[model samples]
Target: MDTTRRQALTLALASAAFPAASASAAPRPTGVEGQRRADLGDGRFLNPVLAGDRPDPNVLKDGRDYYATFSSFQYYPGVPIWHSRDLVNWTPVTAALKTNIGNVWALDIAKHNGRYFIYIPVLVDGDRPLRTYVIHADSMKGPWSEPIDMRIDNMIDPGHAVGEDGKRYLFFNGGNRVRISDDGLSATGKIEHVYGGWPIPQDWIIEGFALEGPKVLRKDGWFYLFSGQGGTAGPPTSHMVVVARSRSIDGPWENCPHNPIVRTARRDEPWWSRGHATAIEGPDGKWWLVYHGYENGFRTLGRQMLLEPIEWTADGWPRALGGDLSRPMPKPRGGSGGAHGLALSGFSPDMFGTKLAFQAPRGNDYLDRVKLAGGVLTLKGQGSGPADASPLVFVAGDRSYEVTVEAEIEGDTAAGLVLFYNEKLFCGLGLGPERLHAYRIGQEERWPPGAPIDARRLHLKLVNDENVVTFFHSRDGRQWTKERSFEVAGYNHNVADGFLSLRPGIYAAGSGSARFANLTYRARGPSA
Candidate 1:
């Protein structure tokens, strides 16, 4: 611990976790009606028990129920199963990979024996090669079962184990290990490197030496493993959570003398590049961990899902009692609480729910080009803008929000509302019955005087407030117009590379059809 005394105890723990957001104040982050509710209803709780861009979180539990899932990168309804009993409320259960196949990352979600699996790790794009897939389910609200590509290449974080001679393994992401076939879908060999991680201190400021998320956990007789070391997004104390154990899953492991058991060490911590973790068991039995971070300056809200509380130690090891979470605590005791999120107020236009599904960063085959009847929704045009229009997004874990919709156009479609982040970055406001385009960092400006949206229905509104967005439209919902505002904190993933998160979505694009209507959303509050 000497890089000038660990940078002076990381600036005294970032001046006690309360001095980082400053460019005049900055630090809004609150959520509930627009989602981001980490309980806090009297019994206390808060620390993203799942919020925007939930990265690498993979919880399982089954039995008093708990299920979680994240890292849905290109987002196509990919890996979305959430549901909780008392792991601090949660909802949405369904979307077990409706085929997009690429860019998805860190998943695991096991159930075993009675069945229910999900391994995934795609990343395809460009120089190709990087695979690992598997999906299965006898029930977790899913018929789930199409992936199966375990052709296992370059690896990216799998971690599903079951040994003590029961066989079946998956481990991976540098410490490697494979051989899993017995109904858990393919791969039954090749890929063993077996444990070499946990050794970080050489000047320590880190963001490299990327060990990657492993998450094994067997308990009692011991198999443990839990990983992710640095580099899961750069320095705010680059990612942590480490541990190692092994009474026998076959190995000489053993490294948790309280090793990194959860980190963030400072940057005015309110969660920031925390770690990958995943160690569950708590419906009353206690012991938790489940991780992912980055909320400090709201890394555009990308690495969320947090939940802490861990104990163990009487020589055994586990520790991370949840500090740096910034506030509220006590809430995970005896299960039984359900219904936690979803209802970004579409203001009843026949209300669709699951936050108004439209997903397509790649496939769902455009749901046969969409239609949605009654409360409108239309769609049909395609790539002429917003990076090849695949818009329909929704996973807005609030940090100030507003969204609105209406749009109508029919023959030369343009359709509106966007915030998107993947068809090569995004920006919003579209309208086309005459003109009003805007999109920003990903191009498409056109509004030089703009006033003609001469009816094909109108009304647009975006308003992020925290990220400073603005832009409005309206034609009859009472006449309004603003037009542009922009800011969006560079639209995330460090100037957009893909671990996405900026979504707000809706897009039609070129030639013939576009409907959308009423839409709504709401939230507008915290961001500092």
Candidate 2:
């Protein structure tokens, strides 16, 4: 096939899957209790099996159960595990890693001989080099062991596989592999470059030839490797899922004839940068691919988990069947179902370790500074504001939602709620007893005509209607005052550096401790 003509045909095939959001006659995306739910309840479902910043999803199928975890960068008690029976509907299980490992990158999860393993890549800068580690557990709901140093060079996104000779291997980003010990505790050798990667067209608008996220799927006497090429967050058509396979773990691999199985061929598509794919055998004995993609026009949500059904070719190759995946598709058969997500109603101490209900950045050491009891969260203040205080944040999946919290300042402490991407890029309203503190993009100032705040207590609420945010404060729970509103569409990875989503959270700053109560979250449909 002529290169240019072949690429055009591929793009055409990709576009055929996408019907504009309004073009489809199928029922539009509906919600359950104001929250987005994928399963339509009529034996059909939508894309984004799990929303929010669930990028680089790694799922391990165990018997009748399915367990998954995503790349949790800087969120402590990292690599959150989710449980699913039907695959479409999921709930939080437990976070695997407790200790803070550098900036967590793409990872993979596998169950081997009754033990579960998660291959983690930590991105380190300065004088140190990038390193990958492994964590193991006797059970999914873990008492997981401390991360063991894999001690390999030039590796990221490690995928586990077993060779014909019965030796265990970890396939890494950029087509590399390393041998693992039988105990699965440590690395046995140096990393070796095996497969180069699929050749990409020079004319295609992509981020780069950044081939990474290698996941191994073994079935019917073949070891199939699914990987992401092109940069993860660049052009709309950049990131993609490509497949290659070998009879033995070590071999000259063959790329799928229909390469780049899943991609966002155009910017107008429903999802963007669709890649980092992991294939699984569905509940109905059908093959399915699970990957991550940025929802079109909403990069602030980060990359979300997308489920696409796949078909196997007669010549023993697989192809993704989900077109641009804008429309609802029939649900998979056989598996059971349940409610989809966790409730961020308040600080649920019971759901503490399992769900990242509230997470701190950089330092997981801040737990010593927090006390949660009876619907109240008290924090010992640090630094001066959200930037240095190391706030406790949670990802808000909905494009529009409302968050309210009541804070009682103790001594000099100031606490309130805000939408934070990182320390540098955040905006919120805080209480300082005598004055109301408003944090704008690059500067903090008083909300002129500063209303006096009680040192003892005040309630703060934020409504993010799309990217525009409005702050309201109340002396009593019912009586509210709208302080100000600002635009926050730029508080995302594209504007900010870290690969992070803008999250809703609270912070405490100053010398004394601050007590927070009535932290409630409600999702509203996107504003007109």
Candidate 3:
């Protein structure tokens, strides 16, 4: 089909799939309601171009399609690259980095001269030192090259750009930039101060001035630099998006007249600490901004991906158009193709290749902790609970959902599924040799007078709706009984220091191994 005809068909399909008026419906219990674009069955659509816990987003438009990825700190099988044609609905194409590359942070994904590369800045575990690495792929899809240490120490965010002199460069935290070789693999020059980020007025309610996450975009003969400042966490008013631009890549850059393009000025806002952004043009040639923010009262959900439209003023600076981004906006135009989200249903061996991963394992051989064979996931015991076990997990966006798994305990091991946050804060259910363990506030409690069960084969299910979690068990697949229920709204950042979410996961801890099968997960949407 021709380009114009294809664009029209895409628009028609999106309109039918998402209607703008429908997109503005009453907010759902999950708080993500009325955020998705109305598929008007035409190719064009509405807002939140991407969804879920996809924070610190960095997108690269390659040819006719766009590829994006985000911070996958602690989560191995990290940096899953998503592809989108329309920018509204995205599908995971491949997970670029499989090996544990430290605690991954805000990264830059870019393409130059027909080659794709991802510059990752990570926080090393033992030393707590910061380092940046580069990984290359001939095509967006694997096989990708192993990570090459960039040797640019103590950096967190790596923003790639091409200099006016044709030199490759990367701008990192603290407004520093280092030159890279033409191969785009290693650093060649010393890190130098290039741009001084905007300053926040003192006495203003804010987090600290932690100036970081710089993204550079070359547009209309100008080099635009976007950065996040005022700390990422703490006061709801902290963290904000700022912009600067210069005629030269090596600049005397000027800050935006309206320095903060986006920020959370009050606690009443639906989202807080909103910053760390990357700007890109929509398929229709319109501008849009992608960033991350902590959902109000859902800090345990971590920083979620957010989208806002951008309007370029006559003076050349761009401003976020969606206000607080708590409401819906018109969708991007043009382009067709790509799926909206990931589905986790079927179980099979080798499935861990991408869909699931452990959060910051002690070593690379952590995969040895679990055996995936014969459609069952057998995990060895580790630590005492979900906190230490490095439970295998996946990204989930719904406020309420149910997860079920069949497990057969062997040896002296205990195994079950859990909603895990960190070592000090988390809650869920677990099954052991003598009794079913109910976990709340990082401690396990036994209930129902505690009945001992020797059966090796058992099914477990957890139903979590709006932060309240209930557990269930069954000896046979047909008959079911409630095990226990626990309220877990407190399993969040206020109690835990890590800016992590309470994730649904499966874990094994004790001495032996537990075999798991028929794992199923389903989300209860707004109506539920």
Candidate 4:
């Protein structure tokens, strides 16, 4: 090989090696696996505090601790709740809901009367409309109860609230509220339309006047209702946070003069379609809003979790203090922990639901396909290929990162790594008995089919630099050969129609089994 080629392969070798003990801490990437971190380690922090498809964030503040979760969609062991002492730093402490109820949507997490409850709104099927369910646990790290059917029909987002009458309530989409029992298990009263949504100007462009995500905060005798207006996605201007306030739960509500508290005004901004926010009091006595937004030009990464500050106006209205959020702002005080990601170097069994998950989980039976033991994952393959299989995916929040894994195929299974977005939309290379199946544009694109493989056991490496992707192979885990390079900037929600990110996935498809060992993931610095 030429000197230039040899040097490039050598550098790749060094970076792909599992991070070893070293004191060269000359400003390495902060988060686990060198992923782009939110905390800058200089007191300030950046947007998307928790990255990679963390949409519809629900944050609950309990004394000095904060527990947060998001919409899990089709992934099993859904609603993975993360624990944080500081809002900026978080780690997945547990997956609250393990049962496959349905396609989970926006939810609300609240602590009521010394017990924790999660109000989940799910869409089962076309014949059965959307319904709400409730699950509770004594602690954030939970043995959560199975979902209790609240019989809340036709609702997509459910927010919990407490009234002055010492009663519990839940607010739903389209300006409606329902009374709940004291135990926080089921709905007690009829759904009542409380207030109409804020009107948008006729000249503005938006997907729809869809009003949803009603999170209530009672402060200083005034209950603030923050809801999202405009559709969740469609236009650059779609989706925003609007607020209303009422002195009592009984009504006489008024809209915040500064309606649409936060929005993406232009297509050039860093974050777009920003909505579904939860207001939380910072540990340091300050106030902040935990929201989600699509990182512009990187929507394939999905709606990332964002943190911004909010201040109460002199006129008693709360206003978002962070500007367009194109740059880093001063972080809120009192959060203390590691950045939000888990390096997949070891599997403690707890890793299944916490950091790694299966997409489009059919049921608890899908769990039968995977076996984790001694840091090696032996996956039994099902389906003809990745499109039919429930691929194992993990959280990847970095703009640039590398995933390396050693695979030994058993039977007819095609085992390999991929950047997966749902079952229908994904791109990656799969290794079968003695051939490579290169996937792109959501399906196998085997035109220049590359060279043939002679063995079933080999080391695979995938580098995602920005949105451009490259795949390589190594026989002895050294001296890698580039298989191909492609651009994946379009592999996102806008292109695929699913609110899913391009997460690194492990797929075992076709026949027998695939044993994955020595898998390592590390976020990369800027292209060198």
> Which structure among the candidates has the greatest lDDT?
4
RMSD (Å) of each candidate, 1 decimal: 19.4, 9.9, 8.4, 5.4
Best by TM-score: 4
Models ranked on TM-score: 4, 2, 3, 1
Ranking, lDDT, top scorer first: 4, 2, 3, 1
**Superior candidate under lDDT, 1 versus 4:** 4
Cα lDDT tens digits, model 4, 389-433, are 788888777676788777778887888889888777777777877
TM-score result, candidate 3 = 0.87
lDDT, model 1: 0.73
lDDT digits (tens) for residues 1-528 of candidate 1: 011111000000011111221222222222223265677667777767767777888888888888888877666667777789888788876778777777778888888779888898898865656888888879988778888787888888898898898888898887888887877788878888889889889887877878888988888888889898888876788889899998998788888976898888878777778888888989888898988887877677688788889999888889988878776789888887666764331223212223444445546575667765543557788878767877777766667767665667689777788887776667887877777777877788755473564656666777786678877876554457786788887788867666777878788878787876555555645442
Clashing pairs in 4: 86-335, 86-336
- Compose the digit string of candidate 3's lDDT tens values, residues 406-505: 6767777677878887666767667777777677777776565745766455677788776778888876544578877787877766567656678777
lDDT of each: 0.73, 0.77, 0.73, 0.79
The RMSD (Cα, Å) of candidate 3 is: 8.4
